[model samples]
Target chain A: MTERFERELMRGSLDLMVLSVLADGANYGYLIQKRVRDAGGDMIKLQAGTLYPLLHRLEADGVIKSKWDHSTGRKRKWYELTPAGRRRIRDQALQWDKYAACIQRILTPALAALPAK
Target chain B: MTERFERELMRGSLDLMVLSVLADGANYGYLIQKRVRDAGGDMIKLQAGTLYPLLHRLEADGVIKSKWDHSTGRKRKWYELTPAGRRRIRDQALQWDKYAACIQRILTPALAALPAK
Candidate 1:
């Protein structure tokens, strides 16, 4: 099996991934972690340390909002996209697509030019 | 035009892009920078600061080797890939494809789920 993409490759797009998941609905940290994991199909695993900092950063950046909920009988913090975050999702997603396409252009010919494996 | 991807997005894939350019033939720093810029269609501009350090690192990694040529009378440093560098290109390219696919899976549906702009 091909090795997973190195962490650096995933770092740039991670905010987009989490924002995308929230587009489906509001979620707490654990669910966000699971969704990213499941969406990447074994390529992504958002650790708590990574996820919380990212979530906090996004909140601090005004892209997301969080609130405490005790309605579930235990206090849990839920996160949802703000208007800025929705726009961020749109913006970052577009940028990510373009970047991926550029990579494809370089990679395809480079691979073709290689002596066949 | 959409804004160029932020530096972080480009940073992760920088090595792959340079290696791809080198795969075409032995090249000096300026040409590698030019090829990446042209191929990215204005999305990439591999500044000398970024390019040289990366070249040195790749050289240190033993994936690429460089030689000084005075035949041009400019004492240019030319670089070419080693066998390991070629192998790195293949492995990185495949991983990038899978990772891009994963992003697509999450992004497409997430975009769909958004309220119409």
Candidate 2:
């Protein structure tokens, strides 16, 4: 699939996905991107344009908090989910699961009805 | 999950899912909604506010076409996938598969890393 298409699919759920990663522990921007890529099997990567704006929005909305960490001898903005963010992630994850299951149900039968290749 | 949340998750994929359902056979709005709900295990339902606009938009885009069917002694707008809609469904289904696989990969590891409940 084209990167654009994958990105589009990722658009709506990006916030929840990011929060999910952060739920494990706090992470810096680059590391967050790396984790997502590693988990996506290298097929999905976040673009700076999409990532930064979302981070900013999440921070502004009080869903996430950021602080500069210089413990590694380099300054990086580290992000973690807030209480609200954690709640949001839970709700979003549950919602995603239900949504996916519903869509799968709708598609499976229709797909089965297709003529065999 | 709230209907709103499910709808949000459905936003990006609504068009493609609808096309996929239509790809199976021509259907009217209520039936289309029924098919989706039945397949979604009744957990996911489409609102008229969302569904009608999407249908209009797809029709305008020439991805789908609608005609009035009076066979049941009632006038119902039946929608069928156009050739473009069919092709779009193929592309979208492939994209959804790849995107889902990628997200699953990322989420699985992060989720596994979380402390046991």
How far is each candidate from the true structure, as Cα RMSD in Å? Answer: 2.3, 3.2
List of clashing residue pairs for candidate 1 = none
Q: What's the true lDDT of residue A67 in model 2?
A: 97
Write down the DockQ of candidate 1.
0.67
lDDT of 2 by residue, A1-117 (tens): 245456556766777778878988998788887777677664567777778888998899898999998888788999998878767766676667767776676666656654543
Model 2 lDDT per residue over B1-117, tens place = 355455556756777778878878899888887776677665557777778888999999898999988888878999998777767776777677776766665566655665543
Go through the candidates in order and give each one's DockQ. 0.67, 0.45
Task: Name every residue pair that clashes in candidate 2.
Answer: A102-B40
Model 2 scores a TM of 0.80
DockQ of 2: 0.45
Regions of model 1 farther than 4 Å from truth: A1-5, B1-5
Q: Which stretches in model 2 have alpha-carbon errors above 4 Å?
A: A1-7, A41-45, A60-63, A70-74, A83-91, B1-4, B41-43, B70-74
